[model samples]
Target chain A: AQTVTQSQPEMSVQEAETVTLSCTYDTSESNYYLFWYKQPPSRQMILVIRQEAYKQQNATENRFSVNFQKAAKSFSLKISDSQLGDTAMYFCAFMTHVGGSARQLTFGSGTQLTVLP
Target chain B: GAGVSQSPSNKVTEKGKDVELRCDPISGHTALYWYRQRLGQGLEFLIYFQGNSAPDKSGLPSDRFSAERTGESVSTLTIQRTQQEDSAVYLCASSLNRGSLNTGELFFGEGSRLTVL
Candidate 1:
């Protein structure tokens, strides 16, 4: 079974600063995908970033990026230039293909991020 | 709809009452997912549907929880004799298809908050 872990329960950052949310996973599958999702006060689960295990290159989307260390089973999300809008609950999830079909996302507990002005 | 839509955004019912939550996936999406998120927690995958066929229902907590989807459109999750532990935000997400290993990203709805007293 795959499991995701987010050690930080809460995080805070000042506007224009950077914040990094840590995530780790336990999976035996060599081919898999990792993701970070942000849920705002509106309760909409928005995809923040994604990383494919086969690729060594870290995925970056604008100010959001991920450091995926396959050997360590660590996939951490870095949010640079944090804005007030970044205040939300962030979750780290893992996905893998099983018998040519991808399985459902396994998520970590989550990290509550608050951006202070 | 422009995005995944979930009905009864907020539901409050007494324990032992049955509740039905609805989710309308984005048109053309062949894969739909249901997740449960307790307050301040991460997403718990409940079920996954690929074109009306559920290949993964392993995340469902108990027998009281069941879900069904019609053709590639709306999906309904029925909770029989709801318990207080079922009080959480039920989130619905959809993707083009789970078979697309490289480019599929789950688009989520606002979620339906269920509270059982």
Candidate 2:
């Protein structure tokens, strides 16, 4: 069994500023994956970034990056140069790599992020 | 569509009524997933289908919730005698056959929002 937790319920960042959303997960499996997804008001879930347990290097995509601490079971998402479009509900998810493929994702409670001008 | 598709973007039904939500996964995708998100909450995984394997229903909250996928394409999640607690967004996602190969990218649909009054 796996569980993800996001302590912050809401966060705000000024346009062109930076913000970091925190996440923590509990898992017994040694091999797994982590992901961050953004859901805007449009109701679409978009992939933000991903991290692999086997890789020590955090994953980054464009202005979105992650700080993955495997020992602490923490994975946080950092948004640099935030824009209005960055406002959304951010979700942290975990997936165990069982027998080579992906399994169901365990998601956190979510953090609502608002980017203001 | 180039991405996953879900139908009945918004469904409002009275408590005790039955509701069905549909999902169309990306073509050629071998994996499909169903998840639930309550208001101000993160995703709650419901079920998963991979290739021709037996679907995993471990995450379903109760017997009132059931889902089916036909030949790795369309999936339908049905709630029998829904309760007020069933009000939430139902999300669907699909991933390439690479799921077993460790590529965990899940293309998601816009989701079907259900309101039980």
Candidate 3:
């Protein structure tokens, strides 16, 4: 099986600043996927970004970017120019194909980020 | 709605009782997943459904938890003899395809909060 770990249980960042949340995982599979999800107070889980194992380049989406160190098995999320809307519970997830088109995700404990004003 | 839909945004049930949570995936989505989020914890994969293949039940914590998806649309997660440990938010997600495929993006619902007391 696979396991994802988020050492930070909580984090706070001032608005317009930058913040990085740490994540690590244990997996033996060579090909897989990584994802970051955000759950706001409304309880909706939203996909923030994704990274593919085969790619050496980290994934980025606007202010959301990832520093993926394959050798260290580390995938951290960097949020730049943070906004109050970024305050949420962030999760790091791992996935690998199970069958033809089936896959399962293993997720970390999560980091509650509060973007302070 | 254009997004995945989950019912009973909030459900409070007594211990040992049975509770069912519903999810309606976005139209045309071929894959669906269920995850559990306990208080102050990361998401735990419960089950996954893709196309007409057998659903993956490996992630289920126990036999007390079972889920069924009708075709490619609606899914229901049933917890029998619920325990206090079952008190958590149940999240549902749907994807165009599994990870490593098309988008590999899972669109999530707001989630159903279950409180077993």
Best prediction by DockQ: 2
- Off-target runs (Cα >4 Å) in candidate 2 are B52-54, B99-101
Report the CAPRI category for model 1: medium
TM-score comparison, 1 vs 2, better candidate = 1
**lDDT over C-alpha atoms for residue A51 of model 1:** 84
Order the candidates by TM-score, highest first — what do you get?
Answer: 1, 2, 3
Residue runs of model 1 more than 4 Å from their true location after superposition: B98-102
lDDT of 1 by residue, A46-86 (tens): 99988878999999999999898999999999999999999
Comparing only chain A of model 1 with the true chain A, what is the TM-score? Answer: 0.97
lDDT of 1 by residue, B4-58 (tens): 9999999999999999999999998888999998987788899999998998999
lDDT of 3 by residue, B22-107 (tens): 99999998989999988778888888888645368788898999888887789999999999989999999988884445466789
Candidate 2, position B32, lDDT: 89
Q: Give the local distance difference test score of model 2.
A: 0.90
Q: lDDT tens digits, residues A10-70, model 3?
A: 9999999999999999999887889999988898989999998889999999999999999
Over 4 Å off, model 3: A98-102, B98-101
